[model samples]
Every structure is written in structure tokens, then in C-alpha cells.
Target chain A: MFDYLQYVRQENFPHIWCAGCGDGIVLKALIRTMDKLGLSQDETVMVSGIGCSSRTPGYVDINTLHTTHGRAIAFATGVKIANPDLNVIVVTGDGDATAIGGNHFIHAARRNIDLTVLLYNNYIYGMTGGQCSPTTPRGANASTAQHGNLEPAFNISGLAIAAGASFVARGDAYHVKKLETLIGKALQKKGFSLVEVVSPCPTAFGRRNKMASPVKMMEQLRDTVVSVEKWEKMTGEERKGRFRTGILRDIEKPEFTAEYAKLIEKMRPEE
Target chain B: MSNDRPGKVRMMQGNQACAEGAIAAGCRFFAGYPITPSSEIAENLSVMLPRLGGKFIQMEDEMAAMGAIIGAALTGQKSLTATSGPGFSLKQETKGYASMAEVPCVIVNVMRGGPSTGMPTLPAQMDVQQARWGAHGDRGVIALTAKSAQETYEQTIRAFNLAERYMTPVILLIDEITGHTTEKVIIPDASDIEIVHRKKPDKDPENYLPYRFTDDCIPTLAPFGTGYRYNVTGLCHNETGFPTNDSNEIQCLIERLTRKIEIYEDDIIRNNELMLEDAEIGVFAYGSVARTAQAAVRICREEGIKAGLLEPTVLWPFPTKAVLAMAQKVRAIVVPELNLGQMAREVSLASQCSVPVHKLGRVDGSPIPPQQLVEKIREVV
Candidate 1:
């Protein structure tokens, strides 16, 4: 048995995350997934940007890099290339990946770098006191927008798939088993992979939206998420209040690392 | 500073000589984009590194080139990147990253003219200020200037050692003239010289902090992939190398980074005085400009104007003390630069004497003629 208790630093636990906080749930799902996949402590590396979710690296037993806000992918790309054998994983929040780090995330996906990116979509900037993030749902109330957000949230799974990620999936941190499986799939993918874990932000996002508790947020997630095939079958009116769940896209392509190595070998026959 | 290769004397441009210097310094990884007078460094490195079981990459741009060098260096290899003007401008962010993260790498800039694309093949020293302040944020940079093809080799080795010793990036500043002008350089065997390696952490992997600093302020460098679990970041960090927004932590980090270099200023500076003992007039210059100043001093002396040249081989640290001490004795100071007047400003600032300072120059592709420099010296005399 790969013990979760053994892998985590006990003193840091009962983490600062609020009750029903999707970040806590996502962390649990990730831990379970890594254990299930049989990735040992030493072979793995976790990297993160600045956010409530980015604190994921601090508690993990594996090698970790806690970098500048929004540049986790860039640093992870460097780490992966420097040692191609290490299993690289990125933990970021919605604001961390899609806003400031959007350029790096898109380029890394398009280039098909072999790495897993777990974007916790809590729909608001939690650690920085709930400014509007890139994925704040339409009309969501945030500190920056007391009048409610006017911007449309990104379909993160769709964005990653369109940007040429080899595997893309969506999961709600409320769905424990599903979240774990999605993470496992991303870890096993040969190229860029993103698992958008739609997490609950009860402290800032939920309380303001009248979904004040984890129970209420989980109920909303359960009601709003529709499978992609069912989403297609649903009427336009039905689609307006819901978000799509399950695998949005999965592709097969040569990863960034292997392809670069191939080019090097071709030019240098002696190698 | 090893003479790993024996009995090799070649007539090579200063830029190519620097490439050979990098090779002799144990640089096995080079990633750079070709630009201006610095193109020869990348071209030579591309030809040489592959033969030594190392990798050489021609990156798409200078930003990536800098990132590549840092990534390569993290693997315990000596790495370098070369660029000029526009390309050098693109590398500032990563250079700051190298500074904050304390990566040991060599950056060679063969400066050309202008704000942007001023003189592609011509010489300029406009980047003297940029060498000190180019990278964003508060940090210390190790800048070394080379005056000849011979010093180009020696300075290249010194750059790596200082970088290793201090755990920071060292900029080798060479103008286009020194980069392109041919000179006689002798290469000795690797066994003949001492090479410095950064002290690594002795603690267990779990206990190692990436940015751990000693009382001397130098951090132990643990080359990546040694199973050491330490993080490196570009953000202002505490001694552990993880990003921190605390004001005190930020202050401590910047203070320590700069103090590490400023404290070692004496050991980091290099310069020379040519016939200063009996001279009444002085010429202050650096890099390739110093070479022409030496010639000008000789020409002025023959014309009955007693003068000497002060050559600054280690530019930033500036050798200001030497200039200030010599300033009180000389009646006049002459500065000749490839740019309009970069180093002349420093000479004027450091001189305590009320000496009349004059500049002999060119922003064009040509060096300041010896006759013109001699005339400038005579006028000041």
C-alpha cells in the first residue's frame, strides 16, 4: 500500500483551506491518483505557481518547485528537459494557468511537452482575496466586480484540446473517484495533458453566490455538470445553466522531448 | 583555468579566442543566436562543443538561448550564450533569472552601436550601463572586459571561475573591434592551470535549501539531478529559493546578492598602467578602446607629450580607485571609445584632479586612428 499518511507532512495538515474548499478535495484526489498510478516518491516532481492551490508542492514528499506566479509551466518545462526521465506534474489554479500564465500554458500544450497540468478551477482568485479570475462564471460576484463579472469563463478543457494537448479531461473535486481517474489518465498521456478540476471556493466564491457551504457547492456541481454527449443532446436553454464534464478531448501525438531528441539524432549520425 | 589542451598557438580574432577560452574553461553546453560581431563566438562554439561530447543549440531567439544555457548548466555542465545589441536586450529577463537563482554560466556580449540595430558590424560600448542595470530588479552582475585576444582567453576562464565562486552569471563584455580583430594567442594544456568549482551542499537531500547562504554570502550550488530536492526561482526569495512576498525577505535577498559581489570588489577588479610612472598626461579606456589608447599613448610620448594609458580589463567594478589615485597626478585625461563617450563619463566622475578630459572617437565601423588619439592627447597636454 502506498500510504497517503506517509507521503504528507503531518504538521502542515488540516490545511488552511476552508471546509468544503475544492482545493483540499483536489489535493486529496491528486494524492490518491499518484498512489494508484504507482509513482514513487523519488521519481516524481511537482511544480506550482502562486495561488491557494499552488501550495500543493509544499506538503508533497516528492521533489517540488514553488515558483513565481503564473510561470509554473515554464519552470516545469525546464525541469523536464533537464532530466527527461523524471515524471513532471504541475499544480495551478484557474487564475494561475489561464490568466498570467496563459501564454506559457498554450505554447507548452501546442509544442506537446510531456507533462501533466492540473488546473483547479475554483472560478476566483482565492489566495489573493477573490479578485475576478479568468474562469469566473458570467455574472459571478467578486471583489473586483461588485456589479458581477461581465467576462465569459474559459472552457478550459476545450482550450487545452484546441491548443493541441494530447489528453484533456474535466472533473469536479466533489467527485472523488472520477477526479482520481482523470488525474491518472493525464499522468499516463504521452504529451501535454490537462485535468481541469472544477473545485469549490466556499470562502470567496460560494458564500458570495449564496452557495455558502461545501454541501451546497457539491450539490450545484452535481446538478450543473452534464456529460459531453448529453450536452450535445440537451437543448440550448438546458445548456445555458450547465458546464460539460468528462473527457473533452484526447489526442495521440509525438511528445516535445522525444521529437527533439529524434531531430538531434538525425543531424548527428555519430550519436 | 586549466590548460587541458597543450601547445596550441593560433592567430584568431578576439571573439574566436573567447570561444577557445570557453572550451578551455570546460564549457560543454552552448545555446545562442547569431548577432553582429558576436556571431563568431556561437559559430566557433557550435563547431567545437559537438566534438567534445557536449550539445550546441542554435536557438530561435536570445531569450530561449539564455533559458537553454541555464537549463544546460543546471546539469553540472559549464554553459554559455553570446549575442549583441538587440539579441542582448532579449536576454535580460533570463539573465535576471540566472542572477536570482545563482546559476553559473557565461554570457558574452560583443557590443555594437545604437539603441537598436545601430551598427551591426561596427563597435560600440553603449552597454556599459546596461551591463550593470540591464536585468530587471535589484541584483549584482559580474562584468569582465577583454582588451586583447590573449586576455580574451584569460578573462573567459576568470568569468567562469568568478561565476562558480560566487554562483552567479558573469558577463564578458567585448566590443566588436576586439571580437573581430586578429591577434596572436597561445593555448596551454589543461593540467597547467587551476579550475574552480562551486562548493556544493554536504547536507542530505531532504535538508538542502537551494538558496542557502553562508556568512560570506555565497550559496552552495547543487547541480540539478543530483537527487537534491531544492527549488530555484526568479522571484524574490528567502534563502530557500522559493518565492516570497514578504518585504523583509525581499530586502534580505537583494542585499545578500549585491553584497556578495560588492564585498569582493578587490578580488573581482583587473587593470593595468602602461608607462604611468613618468607620465604627466593619462588616457583612461577599456576593452578594445584601451588597445587604441595604448597606441595613442606611445604616439604621444614620441611627439614630446608625456602620457600613459590606464587599461581597465575588468570593466564594471570599473577600476575607479586606480583611476582616482592616478587622476591627481596627470595634468590631463584622454578617453577614446568606439561609442561616442561611454567610458569617458566614468573617467571624469572618478578623477579628483581638475584635468582637461578629451574624447577621440567613432560611432562608425572604424577604430579611432592612432594619429587622431595622439593629437587629442597632445591638445589636452
Candidate 2:
């Protein structure tokens, strides 16, 4: 059995996440994955941007960097490139990943750097009250958009794949086992990997969207998301408002830091 | 090509010398984006870093570039980034983050005309004030200005040393004239240069606090992966490096951040005084304009007038002591800059209006001629 408590900073508890919040579940999944891989705490680094999900790094017993809003990926990229031997992970929220940090997000993927990014998507900005985010659904109601958001939500997994990430997957908080496995696989990959977990924010997002309870929100995710195999069998009509989960793209490609190292060797003068 | 040769002289551009200086200072990681008058620094580093076994990344934007260098710095590597006016504006948020978090990094802002990309190819000292106050919140700043390739090289090495000693961001404010102008620079041997590294924590990892204040007001840094799993944040935090809402904790943190440089102002300030022994008129200048001021001072001496030059090598923490001393000795002061009266306002304030200060400025993408400065000095006298 993996002792998850060993990887947690008990002194830093209790965390600031609200009761019935899915961030705790996502946090547990990440800890379990790290435990399964036997990654030493000294060799791992957790980087986060500003959000409720970004607070996940503080509770973990690793070298954590709590950075400014929406720049976690950029910072993580630097950490990994500077020291390629260390295992680097970025914990970010939908607002932090897709809004102000969107440029860094796409570029990190495009470079295919060896960083494992876990994007906690709750469809609304939970930190700043409840504002409409780049990942907010087209018709969802938020504090900033009382009459329903007019912007279409971005498919985070799809964006990562399109941006040239070598490994991309999607998971939800309701399916803890599957999410843990997906995160483990992402860590095992040698290039840019992203696992977007559809989490729930009962305090900010759930109340405004009529899913006021955690059970109701999890049930909605369980019902609306289909497996990749099942998604292929579904017709266009059946997939209208639904999304797919599981590994969407996994392919081998030259990683950024590895390529840079090779370049350094080639450029070195003969001694 | 042989940097190992002691005192080897070669023709190099100011921007190239700045890049060479960074390598000489042991900067192992560079993250930057291309912008005019500053692009050569990035280009030179892109080739130089890899050959030196350092990492160089062309980031997506200025914000990412700044963020990347800070990340690398946390891992115990000397890191830097270069940019121009527009990019400098884009980098302010990260600059403030580095200041608050006390990350040691260097930012080279090759100034050009701007409020928003005013003139890309032209030179301007418009960013002197912005370099000091560009980042939000109350924080002390260290900025250096260079007038020639040799100074850019030496000042860049000093900038890195100061950044490491203070554990803060140091800005190298270079103008288009020096950044693009070519001159013969003597590259010194690596053994001859003095390099300063950040203080590392001597305590065990279990008892280490990343932001614990010591006698120097700077916390010892433990590089990531050294088994010290401490937290670094932009928030106001305690010695434990964790965010706290206690009023006293916030006050302690902010006070130390500002006081670390303020108390050490004597060691941080550097200025060059030229022929002030019997000068009745003083000319205050920096960056490329200082060259023009020096020439004007020479002309004034030859014409039987007593004029002198005071060029500030370090712009922020503003060299107030030297300016005040000059004010006491001279009847009047003249400040000529590429921007309209930016440093003039600083000189006037530093002098406390005890002496008459004259402002001469030009912003049409041209260097202030020596003749114009001589006339300004004459009028001030």
C-alpha cells in the first residue's frame, strides 16, 4: 500500500479548499501517482499559479514554487530545462491555464518540454468570487455573467494535442482510479504531457450553475463524459454536449531539454 | 575568439560585450525574446550559452522570459534576460515578483523611444524612471547605465555580483548608441574577474527556512533538489516562507525587502567624477549622454570656463550622495538626457533645490551633440 501521508506536509494542513471541493480528490490522485512511481520528494518539484487548485503545491512535501497568476507553466518550463534530471509538475486551474497563461500553455506544449501539467478545470474562476473564465461553458451562469456566458469554452485536452504535446489525456474527479492511472502515465512519458481533470467547485461554480451539491456536480460529470472508446461509437448528435475522457494523444517526439542537450554537445569545441 | 588569453583586445559591439560579460560572470542560463537594439544580446547568447554548456531559451514572450530566468535562478544558476522598452514594460509584473520573492536575476533593458513602441531603431533614456518604478509596490531598485562597450562589459559583471549579493533583480539600462556602437574591448581572463554567488543555507534541511532573515536581512537560499522542500511565493510571507496574514509579519517582510538595499546604498552607488576640483558649473549625465557631457566639459575647460562632469554608473538608489556633493561645490548644474528631463527631475530633487539645475533634452531619435551640451553648460555657468 502506498502511504500517501508520507508525501504530504501535515504541518501545512488543513488546506484552504472548501468542503466537498473536488480539488482534494485531484490532489489525492496526484499524490498516489507520485507514490506509485517511487519518486523521492527531494527530486520532485511542484509549481503552481494563483488559484484554489494552485494551492495544492503548498500541502505537498516537495520543492514547491507558488508563483504569480497564470505563469506556472512558464516557470515550470524553466525549472525543467535548467535541471533536466528533476521531475517537474505544474498544478494550474482552468482560469490560470487558459486565460492569462494561455500563451505560455500553448508554447510549452509546442516545445514539447518534459513537464507534467495537471490542469484542474472547474469551468469558473473560484478564487475571485465567481467570474466567467475561458473554460466556462457557453451558457453557464457566473458572477460576472449573470445572464449566462456568451463565450464558448475551450477544450483543454484538444488544445494541448493541437499545440503539439506528445502526451495528452483527460480525467475527472469522479473517477479517482482512472485519474491516478492517467497521471502516472503522464509522469512516465518523456515529453510534454497534460492531464486535464474536470473538477468541481461547489462554493463558487456549483451554486451559480444549479449544481449546488458536490454529488450533483460529480454525477453530471459522470453522465456527460464518455470513454474514448465509447465516444468513437457515439453519433454526432450523442456527442453534442458531451466530452471524451482517457488518453487522447500519445506519441513519441524529441523532447525540448533533451534536444537542447544534444545541441550543446555538438556545439562544444574539441578539447 | 580566445577568451582565455589575458587582456586580449578585440573589436566588439556594446551589446556583444554585455553578452560576453554575462558569460564571464558565470551566467549559465539565459531566457529572452528578440527586440530591437537588444536583439544582438539575445542572438549572441543563443550561440554562446550552448557552447559554454549553459541553457538558452527563446521564450514565447517577455513575461515568459522573465519567469523562466527566475525559475532557473531558484535552481541555483545565475540567469539573465534582455529586452527593449516595449518588452521591458511587459516584464514589469515578473520584475516585481522577483523583487518580492528576492530572486537574483539580471534584466537588460536596451532603451528605445516608447510609451508604446514609439521608435524602435532610435535611442532614448526614457526608461530611467520606469526602470526604478516600473514594478509595482515599494521595493528598492539597482540600475546601471553604460556609455561604451568597455563599461557595458565591466558594469554587466558588477550587475551580476550585486544581484547575487543582494538577492534581487538588477537592471542594466543600455541605450541604442552604446548597444549598437562598436569599439575595441579588452576581454579579461576568467580568473581575473570576481564572481559572487548567493549565500547557501548552512542549516539542515529539516530546520531550513527559505526566507529567514539573518544579519544581512537576506535569507540563505537552498537550491531546489537539495532536499530542502521549502516554498517560494509572491505573497507576503514569514521567515518560514509560508503566507501569513499577521500584520507584524507583513511589515517585517516588506521592511527587509526595501531596507536590504537602502542600508547598503553606500556600497551600491557608483559614479565617475571628472575635473570637479575647481569647477563652478557641474553637468550631471548618464548612459550615452554622459559621453557628450564629457566632451562638452573638455571644450568648456579649453575655452577658459570651469565646468565638470558627474556621470552616474548606478542610476537607482539614484546616487544621491554624489549629486548632493556636486551641488555643494557648483553654482549651477546642467542635466542632458535622451528623454525630456527625466534624470533632470531626479538631480533637482537630489539637490533639494539648493542649486540652480538646468534641463536639456532631445527625443527625436538623435544623440545630443557635444556642441549642444557645451552651450547648455555655458548657459548654466
Candidate 3:
């Protein structure tokens, strides 16, 4: 087994995420990816917003900033631009990245700043006790949407691709190995990279929607999502309730920090 | 990059002077969104910051701008952001966070008329109260008001110094009149100015507590990515920088944050009293309105009304002692502001309504002329 314990705060063990929650699985994958990359804990900074998934930074043994609701990417942008040498990662949730923080999300991607964003999409506001999020599916039950959700869910990966993310990928907690690979690729990308994880939240989202057990929720994710290549071959009827998971978009562009550096050099006063 | 080689005089707008002052104060990061009366600061910084090897970013919104500066400040950089009334309101959310997290940064709010975008191109001092209480919480704010382009330059430097010294967000309140007006500013030699940097922890990384209170009630900060590996959160946290539900611990944290400024009240509070020794009537004012009051006081003194001016450069930590003393000595207090009796109420409360308090206000987005203040002084006298 990998020594993931070396990368986590031992005192912060027994995290606050509820039993059967997939946040731990995704967090472990992140740690393992960092471990594989041999990134020093001192040189890495994890920024998070206010949410259940945002709590991952507290357990990580790295320089962390637990910021306000929905502003992690904005804060991470500053950290990256201020000191581009540090590897900055932003951990946020569905509501944190798509609802209140949606503007920052798209703008950060538009700037193409070098940041690795891992958005844990549990489809409900778990921290606030099952409120309907921007990613909450249609006809889904939530505390705020007791009569069932009336709005269409946001395609997080699609949004990232449209917003000009240099590398956009999707993964699920059930496929831990694949999720680790996706995160590893994102960390290696230079510009804005987004990895949307379809993590399970048995306590808040699963229980309310009748998928009360972790196995049932993982089964739902496993049965519904197909690979991008497989998804392309599916007919409209077959793709009705299904989603696609894999690297959806990958392209190259001038990163914001490097462009800013060139601008500084060009504008600097001659000695 | 323009000319920092000592004793250089240049004609610059108030906003340009503010940007120059920030550069002189060693501000390395600036993130702001454009708003009228304050956009010049952003434009000047965009050109100036890169030239000086500093970072400048025009964030998507005021909230993001405020958040970015806080993030930059955490990395041990002197950061700043400028906006007008509406944008300032958006920034209050993260401004409160900066206060709670003990992040040192500067915020410049150039005054404009508004409950919400009331007058974008006009001047108003309505944000006087907002500067002190805009953000939700029991937190201390250091605010300075500048009356002229020259004063704006000097006060911007002082704002950064105070922010670093106290580890809090300092507000520089400028108005449309002063922010846009151009005047000659003497760029002082860099050696003549005093720059204060935040204290760094001397302890090893394993033993460092980001919020451990020292003798002065101020905690040393360790920059992110420096092997400190600590957390920074806006929650009511313990000395270790982790959230705590213990009421006593919360009380200690809040008290230390507030008392750090309260105990240093004398050093933090700054005011100027002109001809106050023999005056029977005192006019209290700040920002652009203070200029008119100074002129009005001159006219009143020539007309033998014994009127003087009390202008506070530092607005928060409120200058209570001076206001009370001025009320006792003067027969009446006249407060001339661009808003309808905002700081006037503060003067009245501070004086306990002992003296006849007259509030001369204008909300038409125009500055109160010196003659109008003189007329108000005559009516009070």
C-alpha cells in the first residue's frame, strides 16, 4: 500500500465527512497523485471554499487556505499570480464552484491561469444539509427542493470546456485509479485544469434520493456514466439518462502567469 | 519607475498619486475592478506595477478583486485594491474576512453617491459610516480620509504602514473631487519615508501558531509556501488557526483583535485642529468637505466669529477624545459633510448633545462650498 499517511495531518485524522461519503476516496486519490509526482508539501498550497468537500484542505499536511464560500478559485488565482513557483490546487464542491462561485469559475478558466481545480460534484449542498445545488439533477429531492427539483442540472465538464480550460476531465470516486490518473494529468498541465469528480454523498444527497446506501449510490454512478468514446457511439435513447466521463478537452495556450512575466520583462526599466 | 531618485515634483491626479504612494510603500500586488472616480488608480497601477516587478490583475468583480488581494497578502506581499461606492459594497464580504484572518492589505474607497449606484461620477461622503461598519462583525478598521491630491499621496503610504503595523485592512477614503483633481506632488526620497512590514514568527515551523497573541496582542504571520504549512480561515479560530467552538476561546480571539487597536487608540487616531485654542465655534469635517471647511473657517475668523476647523485624518478609532474636548471648549459644533448628517451624528453623540450641533449637508453630488459653510457657521453662532 502507498504511504498516503505521510501526506496527511495525523492529528486531523477521522475527518468530518460522513460515513460512506466519497470525499475521502477523492482526497486519497489526490494525495496519491501528489505522492507520485514527488511534490514537496512545503511547496504546495491547497485552497478551498466553504463546503463539505472544502474541508479536505484541513486534513492535508500542506499550506492551506480555507476561504469564504465560493471564492477559492479567485483566491487561488491571486496565490498563483503572486508566486507562480508554488503549485496551487483548489478543492471546491458543486454549489461552491457552480452556484455562488460560478462567475469566478468561468473567469479563472478564461484567464487560463495555472491552477489545478478538483470540483467534487455530490449534486447537493451536503454542508448546508441537502439544499438543491446548481448541479442537482432535475426531479431530484433536496431539503430546499422538497417537491423535487424543477431546474436542469449543469454539465460541469462542459462548462469548463466552454470556458477555455486548457485541460478538462471527469472522473468518479468508484473508479479511484482512473480518478488518480486524471488528477495526475491535471496537476501536470500548465494552464487552468479542471477535474470534476462525481463523488457520492450518502448522508445528505443519497439518503434523500432513496439511494441511502453507499453501494447503491456507487452503482448509480457506475451504471449511468460511460467513457467518452463509448458515449459517442450510443444512440439518443441509450444516452438519455447517461453521462460521459473521461478527458473531454485538452488544448494548449499561453498561460496567464507566463504572459504576465513577459509583459513585466518588456515593461521593466533598463538598468 | 517614473522617478524615485528623491525630491522629484510631478503634477499628478489624486488617483495617480495614490498609486505612486502605494509603490513607495512597497505594495507588490494590486487587484482591482474599474469603477468611476477610482479607475485611474487601476490604470496607473497596470502600467506601474509591471514596470516595478510587481503584480497587477484586473479581477472579474470587486468581490474577486478583494479576495485576490487577501490571497496575495497571505503570501507576505503588500497588496491593494481600489473601487467606488457600489464596488466597495461588494468588497465588504471579503474585507471582513481579511479582518478575521488578520491579513494585512489596503483598500481604497473613492466616495460616490449611492444606496446602490446612486451617482457614479459625482462625489458623496455617504460611505463614512460604511467604512467603519460596512462589513458584518465586531472588528476594528483603520480608515484615513484625504482632502487633497497631495494628502492622498501621503495618506496612501500611511494606510499601508498602518495595515502592516496592525495586521488589518486599512481604508483610504477619497472622494470624486479629490480623486480626479490634479495637483503637484513632491515625491519624497525613499530613505526619508518609514516602511513597516508585518512581523514574522521566530519559532520553528513545528511550533509556530499563526494566531498566538504576543505582548502587543498582534500575532506574527508566516507567508504561505514558506514551510510554515499553517491554515488561514475566516472562522472563529483558536491560536493554532483551526476552528474552535469553545466560547472562551472565541472571546479571547475577538477581544485581542479589537483590543489591539483599542489599546493603541492614541497612536492610531489622528486629527488636525486649526485655531481651536480661542474659537467659540468649531466645524468638524473630513475628506473633500474638510477643504471647504478650512476655507470657511478662515472666512469666519476674519468675520470675527471665532470659528475653527477640526479635521480628522484617521476616521475610525473615531477621535472621540478630541471631539469631546472640542465640544466642551466651543459654544456650538458645526459638521459639514457631503451626506445628510452621517459623521455629524457621531459628533453629536460624542458631545452628548451638550453643545448646539449644526449639520450642514448636501446630497446633490456637488461639494459644499466654503460660503455655504460660512453661512452655516453664522447661523449657529
Candidate 4:
């Protein structure tokens, strides 16, 4: 077993995630990835917005900033630009990153700033007691959507790709090792990178749907996710309910901070 | 960047002077969205910051601009953002976070007539009350005002200094007239000015407590990438910088937010009272309107109306002591501002209604002329 305990704040545990919540699985994967990369605790900063997933930073023993609702990406952008040497990771949720924070989400990707975004898509506002979120599927029951959600769910990976992120990937809690590999690849990417983890929020999201049991939700995620190659080969009708769970987009781009540093050097007066 | 050019005189706009002042005050990061009457500050910094290896980012929106600066400030970078009335309203929530988290950053609000973008290109002092109570909180805020391009430059530096000294967001409020006004500014030598930096922790990383109480009630901050790794949150946190639901801990955190600045009120509050030693009438004014009020007082004095002027550069914590002192020296107080009567109400309340406070306001997108202030003063007499 990996010594993930060495990277966490022992006093803050036992963790806040409920029994069978997939957030813990994702947290463990993040820790394991950090350990694998040998990231220095002192030089890494974890920023989060308001959500159950945003609470991830509080348990980590690193420079963490728990900011206002839906502003984590904006804050993380500043941290990255201010000190490009530091590794910046933004931990946010579906509602936080897509609903109230939609503008910042697309803009940060557009800037292609070097920020690793671990956006936990639980499909509902878990912290706010199961309100309908941007990722809440149509016909899904939520506290706010008691009559079934009328809005269409957002394609989290597609949105990042369209917004010009250098790397975009989708992973789920059921596939823990694969999720760890995706996160490690994102951390290594040069520009804006996003790993949308489809973690289960059983307490808030699952109890309303037919998958009230955490095991059932985990099984549903396992059954629905297909590899990118498998997804591409599927017919349009066959792909209706299934989603791809691998690197969706990857390319090279000039990162914002490096370009800014170059601009400074060029503009600096000669000694 | 060596400040070898001492007393170098230049004709500059208030917004440009504000940008120069930020550079002089060691502000290395600026994040702002363009809004009229304040965009010059952003434009000037974009051209200047790169030359000095400082960072300037035009954020996507007003709230992002505010959030970015707070984020930069946390990493031990002196940060600033400029906006107008509508943008200022958008920044309130994040501004409150800066207050609660005690992140040191400067926000410059160049006043424009507004209830919501009322007049983008025109001057109005309507946001005076918003500067003090815009955010939902009980924390103490430091807000300052300037009446001229030269004063705006000096006060911009003061805003940064105060933000650093107390580790709180300092708002510098100027109006469209002052922001666009052109005046001569003498750039001071770097050695001639005092620069205050945020106090960094000297203890070992293991024992570092981000919000531990000190003798002055101000906490020393460690840069994010440094050895000291701590958490900062908007929640009512304990000294260890983690959320606490304990009643005593919550109360202490809430009280300390205000107490830290209130205890140093003497060092923070600044005002200028002229010819009020024996005058029977006094005019209380600030920002661009103060210039007209000063002229009005001089005219009234020449006309033998016994009028004086009280101009406050620091607007919040309400300058109670100075208002009370001025009330004793005058029978009536005249306040002429671009808004209807924001600061006049503060003067009236601070004076305990000892003197009848008159308000001379104009929000028709034009500044109150000196003659109009003189008329208000004469009417009060």
C-alpha cells in the first residue's frame, strides 16, 4: 500500500466524505499521483471553490486557498501567473466550474495558462443539497429538479477542447488507476489541462435517482464509460448513453506565463 | 528599476499618475477589466509593468479581476485592480473575501454616476457609501479619496502602504474629473519614499500559524510557494487557519477582523482642516468636489462669511474625531459632493447633529462648480 497518509493533514481526518462517496477514491488517486510525481509540498498550491469536492484542499498539507464560490479558476490563474515556478492545481465541482463559474472556466482555458484543473463532476450541487447543476442530466431528479431536470447536461470535455485547453481528459472513480494516470498526464502538460473526474455524490445526487446505493452508482459509471477508441467505433445510436473515458484532446500551445516572461525580457531596458 | 530621477516633474493624468504610483509603491501584479474613467490605469500599467518585469493581466470580468489580485497578493505579490462604479459593484463579493481572509491588495474605484452604469463617462461620488459598506460584512475597511492628479498619485501609494501595513484591501476612490484631470506630478526618488512590505513569518515551517494573534492583532503571511504551507479560507477560521464552529473561536475571528484596523485608527485616519480655527461655517468635502469646496471657502472668507473647509483624504472609519472637532469650531457644516449626500450623512452622524449639515450635490454628469458650493455655504449662514 502507498503511504498516502504522509501527504495529508492527519488532524483533519477522518475525512468529510460520506460512506461510499467516490470523492475519497478520487482524493486517494490525486495523492498517489502527487507521490508518483514527487511534487514538493512546499512548491505546490491547491486552490478550491465552494463545494464538497472543493474541500479536497483542506485535507492536503500544501499551500491551499479555499476561495469564494465559482472563483477558483480565476484565483488559480493569478497564482500561476504570479509565480510560474509553482505547480498550481484547481479543485472544483460541476456547479462551481460550469454554472456560476462558466465564464472563468472558458477564459482560463482560452488563456492556456499552466493550471491543472481537477474538476469533480458529480452532476449535482452536492454541497448545496442536490440542486440542479450544469452537468445534471436531463430527466435527472434533484432537490431543485423534483419534476426532473429540464436542462441538457454539458459535455465537460468538449467544452474544454472548444475553449482551447492544451489537454482535456475524462475519468471516473470506478477506474481508479486510469484516473491516476490521466491526472499525472495533466500535471505534466505545459498549458491549461483539465481532468474531469466523474465521481459519485451518492448522498446528494444518487439518493434522488434510481441508483440510491453507492455501489449501484459506481457500477453505472463502470458500465457507461468507454475508451476513446471504443467510443469512436460505436454507432451514433450506440453512443447515446455512453461517454468516453480517456484523453479527449492533447496538443502543444504556448503557455501564458512563459509568453508573459518572454514579453518582459524583450521589453526590459538594457543594463 | 532604480528611482534615480528624484523630483522629476511631468504633466500627467490622474489615472496615469495612479499607475505610476503603483509602480513606485512596488505593486508588481495588476489584474483589471476595462471600465470607463478607470481604464487608463489598466492601459498605462499594461505598457509599464512589462518593462519592469511586473505582471499585468486583463481578466475576463470584474469579479475575476478582484479574485486574481487577491490570488496574487497571497503569493507575496503586491497587487492592484481598477474599476468604475458598475464594475466595483460586481467586485463586492470577492472584496469581502479579501477582507475576511486578510489578503493585502489595492482596489481603485474611479467614480462614475451610477445606480447601475448610470453614466460611464461622467463623474459622480455616489459610490462613497458603497466603498464602506459594499460588501456584506462587519470587518473594518480602509478607503481613501483624492482631489487632483498629484493627490491621486500620492494617495495611490498611500493605498498600497495601508493595504500592506494592515493586510487589508485599501480602496482609492476618485471621480471622473479627478481621474481624467491633467496636472503636474513630481516623481519622488525611491529612497525618498517609504515602502511597507507584508511581514513574513520567521518561525520554522512546522510551527507556522497563518492567522495566529500577535501584539498588533495583524498576522504575518508566508508566500504560497515558500516553505510555510498553510490554508486560507473565507470561512470563520481559527488561528491555525482551519474552519472552526466553536463559538469562542468564531467570535474571536470576526472581532479580530475589525479590531486589527480599529486599534490602529490613529495611524490610518487622515484629514486636512484649513482656516477653521475661528470660522463660523465649515464645508466637509472629499474627492474632486473638495477642490471646488476649497475654492468656495476662500471665496466665502473674502466675502466675510467666515467659512472654512475640511477635506478628508481617508474617508472610512468615518473621521469622527475630526468632524466633531470641526463641529465645535463652526455653526453649520456644508458638504458639496458629486452625489446627493453620502459623506454629509456621515458628517451629520459623526457630529451628533451638533451643527446643521447642508448638502450641495450634483449628479447631472457635471462637477459642482466653486460658485455652487459658495452658494450652499451662504445659504447655510
lDDT for each residue of candidate 3 in A75-192, tens digit (9 for 90 to 100): 9989999999999999999999999999999999999999999999999999889999999999999999999999999999999989999999999999888899999999999999
Question: Which sections of candidate 2 miss by over 4 Å?
Answer: B1-6
Clashing pairs in 2: none
lDDT of 1 by residue, A128-198 (tens): 88899989988989999789999998878778888889899998876778778889999998899999999
lDDT of each: 0.81, 0.92, 0.92, 0.92
The TM-score, computed over Cα atoms with residue i paired to residue i, of candidate 1 is 0.84
Better of 1 and 4 by DockQ: 4
TM-score of each: 0.84, 0.98, 0.98, 0.98
lDDT tens readout by residue for model 4, A125-243? 98778999999999999999999999999998899999999999999999999999999999999999999999998889999998889999989998999999898899999998888
Candidate 1, DockQ score (0 to 1): 0.25
Off by over 4 Å in 4: B1-6
Runs in model 3 deviating more than 4 A are: B1-6
Clashing pairs in 3: none
> DockQ for each candidate?
0.25, 0.85, 0.85, 0.91
The top-ranked prediction according to DockQ is 4
lDDT of 2: 0.92
Query: Can you write out model 3's per-residue Cα lDDT over B254-310, one digit (the tens) per residue?
Result: 988888888888998889888998889999999989899889999998899999889
